[model samples]
Target: MGGIVLVNVPTSKPLPIMTDTLQPMLRMLWFLLHGILPLAAEATYLIATYYSDDVCSSSYAYQVHAVDVVNCTSLTCSNGEMSSTSRSGDVESTECSTDYVANMTSTLSDSSYIIVLRFEDNNCSTLYYGYGTTELGECVENKYQGGYSISTLNKDGSADLEHFTDSSCSVAYASETANSSAVATHECSSSKYVWYTGSAQEFASNSNGDAGTSFSSDGDVGTSSLGSSHNMNRGGEYDFPPPSRDSSSSDARALTLVSVVFSCIVFVLVAVIIVLYRRLNRQTPVETRSGLWDDDTITATRIPRTKISIKKLLCRGAFGEVYSGVFNRQQVAVKMLLPATRSNLQHVNEFLTEAKMTAMMDHPHIVYYVGVAWDSLSDLCVVLEFMEGGDLRTLLNKYEAERHPVGIDRQKATIALHICHALTYLHSLSSPVIHRDLKSRNVLLNHSMTAKLTDFGISRERLDRTMTAGVGTSLWMAPEVMLGERYGVKADIFSLGVVLSELDVHTLPYAQVKKQCRETEGPRARLWS
Candidate 1:
């Protein structure tokens, strides 16, 4: 009866709709319009305007200030009595009859005007205009000397200032009352505008461009004069107003910044994943072929790291080719089996049998089967093991060439000792075993001349004192077996004796045995008596 084998074939699944090409196309579009280039341009524009000498240059740097106002109902206190505290830990106050709510200053220049207003965290909404004055000559020498200052709000209520200019501004103020605070009915005037000549001395000395009043008869503020403001309902107590939006380019700027940050995070994550994958594969078990083609393609059935990577073929045989390689950080030889010879059942059986049988044994003289991996895709793999020296046949030929050759006396004794140990173990099996084709080529060696018997494909097991396999190399056959006679363990002893006789004459026992067996007569010689 034949042994059973189970084959697992993978099922076919449908491929995804989004192919490889489409992914790159989408990425390219994202880079072109929304990536680093756009972000860089936006940053450059913002920096140039922010560093410009005319507007509030101090606005570019954020700072904190707190103002404590006691018993104040309106922001119209002229006595300047409110206490002011700054992030620098400086506090200032003055004696006055009335207290004002708050005052924080971002000085544009010595004489330039500042417009202070609070912005919502959304960056697109404003709560309400708290207090601001562009009043020209009334500019305080030290902006916080009056002791009234605006307290720094949290991220939800931070303030930013924008310069009202001839080229840029039209001022519109909106107010809301919250927390039952009473509105002051005093007729408040709008802030003034003036041209500051970049110096305290110049600003103080010159009276030319300072405005006498808030706006001369409410004339359009700038040359274009198309500025507009709108209010939206928010919680009924507070009104939300649209921020001074930076004209259509703000979205482009913000989107570009986000994309660049996202891309960089993805790139770093991919690099880490690749490193971990390499480490995992190196530590995985070895069960594959281990050879490399001349074209740099590796053909390894097993994974083995050697001192040096192999790059050439050494020899070929019925099983496959053997290649030079390294193993365990030492110079060793690797045998890579060819694909299964499915046309010949015996060859396939030999290959399968070698892997199964040797995988169980672990001895220095016996060839080691490291492990095995089956590749369902290619249906082939290279088995790996250690090889110290070449086969015994190659070593003997080399010894013959050296002239200080291996003598028959030592050769026979050594071969007998090693073969005896291997066969004795195989024969003493619960069912006695036979090595159907034993030859010099099948005997391998190590650097210390240790011998190992291998190649047991055609071997059979005996049951109940009876064996019925007609197999074996003819030259090593016993005389009785050659005459169509059934034989048992005695046949193996007979073959060993023939091997022993060859050591005496330094000649092969069955050199003419095949020809003699065809003689149309009884057996001619007692070659294995």
Candidate 2:
């Protein structure tokens, strides 16, 4: 499976019944009126407006098209399209759908507005936009003529910039230019026209110079007018209200907002109730995906930090620290991210990936993972079965120091075989996992000396060439991995042989291998000499 993907496709709208020559006919009519009327000497002109989206025509510096998933295959997968969520991005569109609720704030990486189309635990679509962390001042948008400045030469009437004055095309705004042939350029408030375009774009100007349908006086002006109140129902598109039905449309929009907000609150309450019910009933979260839990799966196994009791620190690592701890009255190892590392998003993502990988293992030869616990992101930690026998490296050093026979024995062979079992399970998965950093230090031994593999910090699935970033201890890393080339299951096998060599020599690799050869072959030996 290619995980899950959602594709956004544009919607289609047909032009209201009109012949192809109608546009040219309207142009000729305007020229004839300009030629005949003396009103052109001192006139008011409403710059012709078109219903099309040009990037700069709106105040938004960045646009996010949120792919709306009306019907999901599952929480992880969907197929649909996103309407642009700019405050005015959809005002001119022919259709709108508000089936899903959206929430936004200007607090992301770019310091811009972020609107998310959320489903289950997944944020299906993310949009970052608006004026770079700066809050828009009231009436400030008028400076940009509706916070949307147009400099485009695609002048099929680029803006819905309505200018009326004493002219033949008498409208509410005015421009200095009298002749229809003169370039008419004017800037107006963002509230100009809620028009439609493309093949669906059509207009019949009456005596009043009203090109399209007249908008209601009681319509949302722009981003500033909507404020923060309607975020719950600020969905795909806004329907333009009819002139006379202004009161009714406002009421309808208000009702829609109210109802959608209520639904969202109810959904949140239901989700809370479900979580409480599960916690109250002590329902154990079952493992899924055969040892490769994702974000959702990891969330299922989440426990509050209050349930964990730290005993003592076991070891320190690059980005995290492991502590011997107690959870649900069982001895466990709690691996927590360092306080300094928690603020880095990349580190946090890796920690979560490690949590998911740890939670997915279900084999006896692999370190048993307990639930993860956190009160907040700052206290994030994963619980695993604690090993009383420490790591293999310490055990080997002990035997070598005591002057005991330090070669491959029954116990060492058994340890090697147990590691093989773990590796076999990992490599045989549906999406084969590679233990990229396999070494003696990562192999844990319990009180009974039963070995299980641990430390999945850099392990990865062999789904593609992108999994080539894993480099463990340089001495133990396979040549292909060290060379940064694409490698597979055999890369781990190479590391396994290195481990077996450790069992035979009870020493670290490379340096000691030649030393042993020198002792065995004598000073006169060609290679060792």
Candidate 3:
């Protein structure tokens, strides 16, 4: 008698092996695959196919399967998909089932393929499975580790994610809505959660728009049922999870870092511009010889040169010092070039130009230009009506400090109207004037709260559509001016709107826009907007 001696072999493996009752059968299959049997053929390519009821489309039951007879294919289901695929190298027919939402057929050869990815999305709504046959023996990748998709927002804390041994996903097959925020892992070979099966129609209707809404390009899940415009697969959904932070977190962190860096760089640039402007204003004696005070337009407003008894010093600028003084036995604010910048032609020219323009304007809402007086270039000064209430920004601060809550009132409206009156007169001229630097800082008020528009050095006479751009405070600048587009009188109108807002809120325009930008783009977005 010819008796074959047989050894009883036990399957031993590592801790995290996908090994169980099927291990013996897998071993036999592995042996059959390693040229052990003449009946076994060498598998050249890999393919996966699945049929789903709710293939991430509609709430109806329909069959959608993707077959790749040409190359690698990945099939994804809206609900949990768990159907073992036939290992044959050819496309095999699968009986359409209404009870199961996931039915996958795969031609998986022994781990000798390229791009073997089988992982679920971070949300676990879609599962990506299959191996690539584009280039065999080039690379080996296995993506399936743990977890499943199709996570609905569980307002409650519990998540009952279980599969059924039966075909249906109703109460009889252990179907649940998963009332937790987190996605639960799917157990492909566990006793409690036997196999993944759920109602696509029920899940889609109950997903609350939080459906695991991704599918494979190689195949579709609920496309036939979900005949919507969202049928096309989005870009970059074919890759695996990054080794570190996920895409959203990584992108947020990158954006925040960029915003911070850009903000710092902008702050530095603005500081440098301020420094350069001051330095440029303090010019050398060579540039001061440009006959700044000799200009006929400026000397036309000259008064008898007299000594000014400086009462007290007000604010100081790069070019001059402002002082509350008496001019011709009347209260007035005297603007005198700083002793250091007296010889600076740029400073003298700017002071004279402003004086000339102010003297020409005659309106109660405009700052009164007293007269131009000077003994020599060193003593050159411009006298104007002294505003007891100081600048509008300062007055507003004082009101805020006194806990004076500002509301819509006639007083506020009158002040804004006064500024508007001044603007209307300037624009009504033959060649309309554009107050490019209009802001609360440039608007002065007297004791009775009567406002006046001042500081017209940057103002321009617009003869045509042509005009300079980006000449106003960024916070108060019009949209067109802020973008460096050619502006007209409409730019001043925009600044008036901002001043109105300041009166209403008693805050700087930058303060309000910065807060709003924080909720949207960065604070610098408005300046660039």
- Report clashes for each candidate as comma-separated counts: 14, 15, 11
In order, the Cα lDDT scores of the candidates are 0.39, 0.51, 0.51
Where model 2 places Cα greater than 4 Å from the true spot, the runs are 1-294, 465-467, 513-529
- Give the per-residue lDDT of model 3 (tens digit) for 35-93: 32331221122222222233432222122222212122233442322212111221222
Error of 2 at 490 (Å): 0.5
Higher-ranked by lDDT: 1 or 3: 3
List the candidates' TM-scores in order: 0.35, 0.43, 0.43
The superposed Cα distance between candidate 1 and the true structure at residue 334, in angstroms, equals 4.0
Model 3, total clashes = 11
The digit string of per-residue lDDT tens for model 2 on 248-294 reads: 54465556555654565465456455555565577864544523224
Which portions of model 3 miss their true places by more than 4 Å? 1-292, 295-297, 513-529
Rate residue 470 of model 1 by lDDT. 58
